[model samples]
Target chain A: MTDGILTPDQILSAAQDVLRRYGPAKATVVDVARALGVSHGSVYRHFPSKTALREAVTQRWLDQAHAELATVLASDAPAGVRLREWLGALFRSKRKRALDDPELFATYVSLVTESSQVVEGHVADLVGQIRQIVDAGLARGEFAAPDPAATARAVFDAAVRFHNPAHAAEWSRPGIEDDFTALCDLILLGLEVR
Target chain B: MTDGILTPDQILSAAQDVLRRYGPAKATVVDVARALGVSHGSVYRHFPSKTALREAVTQRWLDQAHAELATVLASDAPAGVRLREWLGALFRSKRKRALDDPELFATYVSLVTESSQVVEGHVADLVGQIRQIVDAGLARGEFAAPDPAATARAVFDAAVRFHNPAHAAEWSRPGIEDDFTALCDLILLGLEVR
Candidate 1:
């Protein structure tokens, strides 16, 4: 493809592929350009530096989960059911990526470590989503949280291991599913109206 | 002092000091030996290798917390109060290490990464302590848990960010104390008999 034909989206897609194949340490903008049949300059035009490229890809990867969780957030189900679904979906989505899509997941993890701001934004976004869920639960009188925002953050902190990429190593351990369930069960119990 | 003047406990103390001063990458058996006025060979005779020394230091650091927490565990206080104190003390101990003792905390984090088994044993030890607390709560009809062991593990998992070395960077953030309290409040609510 010609230089002008290379869009940021196209570059990001190819960058993701290159990152997955070579891992973050080895992958470069030049490799991404090579995969896309474009000059490295073209890729640079879209993303000022390789760091920007990696950050964009990490953002894109997390955005997929954001969208997936958004569905659970907007569902018509009761707050308790929706909260349960949200927690399970978040855990399952990450666990699946870690176990079944190992390469891309590894790439995502590396990109995340390099892009602290991106990870921070992703975490804030996830916390905000939880806030909305808590708000809904409170509005429906299904949950009791004296401070919804703090409750939201507390909930995320409580369940950090199951969904945080840093804890991915523990996901595949035997009985982790049970552990995850038990933790979530405790969290949900904590959130319920008592 | 003779060559056999050194004991593993003494060597571990000197190693911990060296690790705190220079960090894991820079600290070595030689530094610990020099601190003790002995040859590195003497330190090796007790610790075997630098990795073993690091692990021993890490274990020692954790053992301090274990001993402190064991007091809370063995207290005649009600299970709810003991659990609350245990969670708060655990968080406070780690948070203090991360914020107040910067160098040693960094060394501990690095040593933890190198000494997974030691960390695992510490976690299991903590969970076992939590189990005893849960068992007391169950016996006194102060808590409701289908599986006491799972409840203990879940409690540990819930407050992991407060104590886990991986989250040390977040220890000094503004409002973190409130976050810790909020999470513990929620966790205590979860453990309550409703």
Candidate 2:
């Protein structure tokens, strides 16, 4: 209802809705503005370009992921439980997003490979957070691994690799999650000293 | 060069060379014929269509992989060593194909997903071969796990996931093969009981 008082959050929420409906490739700024019931110029006022709008949408997703992880990390649950829950949530969320808006998911994955410094920074930050958890486990003698960072990287890569859209069709078969959990448990077992 | 008695192996060889040079998407029967210094009509004499030629090329690769696995399994080496070598060869060959001819690699990957029956047959055959090795190891107490079929599927899926061209840049990093070996070691460690 407010013309000039629309917040960035409002803009991003509207953009996400448009993304879900039309996908990232076809969701233009004008379409987003139309969905928001606002003038096309108002969308540009918040996001300078379509790429910026798409980036914001991706950043919002990442922010949500970080927020979820923070909640899990703050809980009284054991580190192993927290880590498993976090990964499960991550996988489910990615799968949902992929199914809801494949174009956006494809764009996000492409960004991971594209030589973009900003995307690399975001990825590195996420990796660093996972590494911290692994390091904490190793410090308490909970893990037997010599290289916590490497193990963390491997786990992160495995989770993402398993959830890839191309892999997901077959990977979504019966007992797939059970198999994934088994793999994760194996990693944890390997990290645990006898 | 012989017009009247071209073997299937020779046809496949010519196709592979053409694929390497022109990529899977651009490689046509005419191109394969030109590469072999034969008339297009002669090429058509052996293969009915471009799709048939592509299938022949893929089948050739599959045969090579099967032959290699057979040799590794029949070797007198220890199971663990055999597994490591087999996985190393698998990963290396996939990486080489992805880098050397990305279009063809993409086409092959697409083919697996394009038809469920085709992929199921391919997976079944591959799993059967790997299961034999795992079964032997289990009988000898070298492997502690019993579900060799499922484990074989996981290994094959992981290899496919890791060797994706999308991940090639990451895999090209120094000591990536070492990282993959570490991952394999983790899998092996998890397979062992105790």
Candidate 3:
């Protein structure tokens, strides 16, 4: 019950619950403290300000989004297949969050909009995963990219329609999966040629 | 001076002025008519309803956006050069709109959002142009796409952040042109491997 015993991780966990229940605009540090059965000061001790807490929550959500895809990225599969799977996993993770908990995902989207640093960090993380795949491809002689990082970014940009949150409204359209496959095939072919 | 004397093109030209001034939300059929110094009835005669008029205006904007690129599309240049020029033109057109008259570009973005049909038609036109170059590439054995239309859409989607209004906020970032070049090079490389 003491502030000394409470940890930042516990505060973050409770904050996520409060966020999901009330959404971003209505959720507050007090609300998160209430969810944790702790005093507001206790919560503030862990997070310097509400904005820092919100950014941390956004970073947490982003981390969760990439967690599954990280497995695919770390897998021993062929780099090309791993690249495709990584992208597919990324899209599925986001789509799942949107479909399974629309409110939470929407809240996360709003929070992300407010935290550009979190977004930049999240993007850097995802692109780094992509770079790993590109590096693997280069090692296997399957890709001829002169710069793996740049190639990873191009692949990311190419797949934005399928994975970018901005285009979420269009993802449910008919033939989207087919379009995703076709696009991946095209990009992979491009990578194969260097 | 009469309804019979005012052509639809004249009405649309005036409507664009109204839209640029008042934006999509406040712009009206009355405003368009006022801009042309004609009765609303004449405007209605050309466009059955306000929605129809809005759609037509959007189409007009899209047409103007593509006019120069259409020339590039119809050129006798190599398909690769045409494709690169076509994408470059499209990006330049959008960037020019965003830079020259951000208010108008923002208004057009909202108008396009409200009129999905107009957006779909515009995309189809752009993709169709892409398909033409893709088809030519296929014929010349510069591309190995089995379905030019699908590949065309892939290319269009790949370069979306540069052209799509949704990401207008990020377009102003420095090094955008370099990013565009890197992406185009990647996709072009992809398309080259039949």
Candidate 4:
């Protein structure tokens, strides 16, 4: 109903709630504007296009997950432990979203389906987190990867079974935790090779 | 068309053709039977249920891929080369399947989605193949993995992006080949740590 006063961040925040209520397919800019009590033109002024707004929401959702892992990455734990915890955190975070809020997770999955670039950016951010842990390990002489960034990528891809949305169904099966730990150990062993 | 003369193999061959022609969702046992000029009863006799028939077709499809890689695994080449070639073959095989026969591959993806057990068995077979290669490498003192089976699983999970149908869209992205090679090199380094 009003404009000029509501920040773009506030509109995105309101859009997320509208998105959750309406779901991705039905959610519209006017609905987001209505939720924010602002004119549709105001929402358009901030995002320029509905796609941009949805993408921003996607990025915001991803960044929330990224922020959780950032804490682990920034912690002073040993690099190896930090690496393990970093990956564990990512898996748990995704699983929580999937299990706790299935509808919202479905909405995000739709958003990701519509925009591969969002998933790519999310993955890039994850790899960057892993790289930090790896670089720390290499500096501490606890790991021997030739390229920290490449190793970060390999580690991320290797654990896709547990974290990748595609294989989410498999994550709930019995003994999956064991599989995760076993793979992590193998990677850690490979990382610790001196 | 005579029940006494028509072998199960012939029925399966016709089923493959019918599945390809109609796609999995519309394809039926009667269609398969009709294709072979036999009664649906004959098809039902070989496969007790439609699920069983679809599963058998899925297994048949997977076996084709397995048979190709089995040759690489069973070769007399060094284990390192064999492992690299084995992974390369798997990625290439999957890529070929995804690209060469999009319809059949889509049918296979749908089948796998319906039957997790089939996918589980396929993964087991692949992990078994990797285990054999790892065991051989360890025996020859070319690799140092403590658990060849677990290592094989790690390697399989790591290279999943290249092989998993869910990530088919990303496989065609520019620089994906480099990403594959980089990850493979990282896994190889981990395996070769002595």
Candidate 5:
């Protein structure tokens, strides 16, 4: 698209490319504008400030994964299967981002501290997905949870090593996958009807 | 304690004092000696190098906690109760160290990366303690674990947020204790023979 007709999507794509090149530190509204063949004002028009633009990039990256997870939830599989798949998908996606696109991955991770609301929303959304699966399990008499919300939170927190960015360094360890699987199995056990 | 004669414990105590005042980076044998009213050579006689001295200090800190945990394990309580108390102690000790002695905790955590063998041994030791509990539980037929070692690891990893230094910043968050107890309860459910 031409500079005059720059859409937010077009600008976001360009912003991603800029962030991928220079990371969040050196990359700025000016660079994003340069990448999109537009002035800084155009980028600012869509995102009021540099932090907003960076947050948008992070939000966009997270939304893609969210979309994929939404598909897993949309699947007609058993709640248990969906729950496992959902967590696996989250871990796999995060692992890939941390391993494959390290620059962009780091960009978003660094933003996580500054953009608390974004991070908070992302967590709440993911936990909500888990809650849905857990609530479904309880409703189907497939699981026994004294507190369904806490059950879901426990499951989410239980697998923290698999998804928490701080533990990303261990994600590549030889037995980390086995560790993830073991934790998942145990959580499933805890969630199943007792 | 004359200046000419000093025990390793005395040097270690002085080193701890020096570390508390100067942290690991600026702390040196000379500083430790000054604190102990002895020559730096006297300090070096007990510790060959700064790294060795720092490692010794960290080992001392961890050993004290290890001694406490050993007592918890020696208790005649049921394996389940022992397990709960054991994890609780680990969490509480780490939490207290991080909160009450921020400098020392930061020193240990920073040393963790460079001192992989130290960190690795610490983890192995802690995991072994958990494994002991799991083995006892299985021996009494009080817990159901297909793979006892993996069960112990899962339990440890499941509570990473409560104990991991990386999440130390969140240790002060309101309701974090409830979250810890909630996770422990879920894990206990997973462990008990069903």
Candidate 6:
């Protein structure tokens, strides 16, 4: 491999792959270095430690999620349609990633609880996007919520809770998504054109 | 202690304490026997193995939760009021039991995933109770929705999600119960009249 300068994005991509393969606990800096065919010193120069590497990987995942969500939200669709489609996409992505790679999913859930700052930052951004949508809808008399921020948080929380595979087996039978969509519809109903 | 005849309830109570203290992995038949001041043989007579004892403890916990909910529902209060009051009580109970007793909670959560029958039984009972309230409100033309069962499930899911300390922190700021009350008020708003 050429000794060309490795970009932070490349390092982040490699770190994500390692984390997806081995859990955060087992994914070491040396492992990432080995994956990149680089020296431990080279990986350390960018990440400092395993914790730093894990944080970077988590941030990268969040960044990607945000970008994907932005694309969906910005699509030329009605607010309700966009919201439902975005949630369906998000849930599907989470399900596929979790089923395809349990280790990474476990590590991400652990990080959400352990690294509050990183998780909170990501949640704040997601919540902000939801608030913006809700606010715009309310302004146009398309929704009727008194507090868009709280409603947005509730919507996000419900989506996360409903889509969790651990809870999925409990909620999702055949046509389970229908029930979830109905719930979202009711929440949106509370904010409907009045 | 006398060599008294122990009921299944007695056995479960002793096992619950042991599981809460030592966790399912560490709480063996011998440990539970010792905690109950009974012979290991006695415990073995009731539950052939540690797994059996743990299952009994979990079932007992679910039974207790169901009993509490039943009592609330059987009260003369209006359906909406009954639900809100019962849900708040349930949230407090779950938080105290689940968080304060992590070992027991871990065992319960793990057991639900491992044994779908156990989770299904509990979920069925919970859904039934929720359906009763939602149906009652709908009969009175209080709620606007046509699907009472789905609405009930959403409320149940929301309550469970809110019971998690981390998630509840989002709304349980200073005077946050007011927010929760308001949310509930909105949910049951049209479903009942003052």
Which candidate ranks first by TM-score, i.e. highest?
3
Report the error of model 4 at residue A1, Å.
6.5
- Candidate 4 has a TM-score of 0.93
Q: lDDT of all predictions, in order shown?
A: 0.85, 0.67, 0.85, 0.84, 0.85, 0.68
TM-score of 1: 0.86
Q: Model 3 reproduces what portion of true contacts?
A: 0.74
Q: What fraction of native interface contacts does model 4 preserve?
A: 0.50
Task: Tell me the spans in candidate 6 whose CA falls farther than 4 Å from its real position.
Answer: A44-50, A163-175, B1-4, B26-53, B107-114, B163-186, B189-194
Weakest ten-residue segment in model 4 chain A by summed lDDT: A185-194
> Which ranking of candidates, highest TM-score first?
3, 5, 4, 1, 6, 2
lDDT tens digits by residue: candidate 3, B1-194: 77778988888888889988887889899998888878898889889999999888888888898789978988988788888999999998888888889988888888898877888888888888899999998898888887777788888888888889888787888868778888988888888743
Candidate 4 wrongly placed segments (more than 4 Å): A1-4
lDDT of 1 by residue, A1-194 (tens): 88877778888889888987888889988899999998898888889998888888888888875667888988989887887788888998998889998778877887787777987798888889888889998999999888888888998899989898778889989999899888988888888986
TM-score of chain B of 6: 0.76
Query: Candidate 6's residue-wise lDDT over A7-123, tens digit each?
Result: 677788888788778866677888878888988788778888877877887887766644667787788667777777777777666666666766666677776566878866876
Q: What is the interface RMSD of candidate 2, in Å?
A: 2.8
Clashing pairs in 1: none
Q: Per-candidate DockQ versus the true complex?
A: 0.71, 0.34, 0.79, 0.63, 0.79, 0.33
CAPRI grade, predicted model 4 = medium
All models, RMSD in angstroms = 3.1, 4.2, 1.8, 2.0, 2.0, 3.6
User: Candidate 1 docking category?
Assistant: medium
TM-score of 5: 0.94
Q: Give interface RMSD for all predictions.
A: 0.7, 2.8, 0.9, 1.4, 0.7, 3.4
> Higher-TM-score candidate among 3 and 4?
3
Error of 5 at B151 (Å): 0.4
Give a tens-digit lDDT track for model 2, residues B87-177.
7766676777777766667766655455566557766776676677777778777776545666766555555545444465555567676
| Model 6 residue A151 lDDT score | 77
lDDT (Cα, tens digit) per residue for candidate 4, span B39-154: 88988988999889889888888888667797898799888889889988988888888988888888888887788798778889888989999999899988888777778888
Could you tell me the lDDT of residue B40 within candidate 6? 87
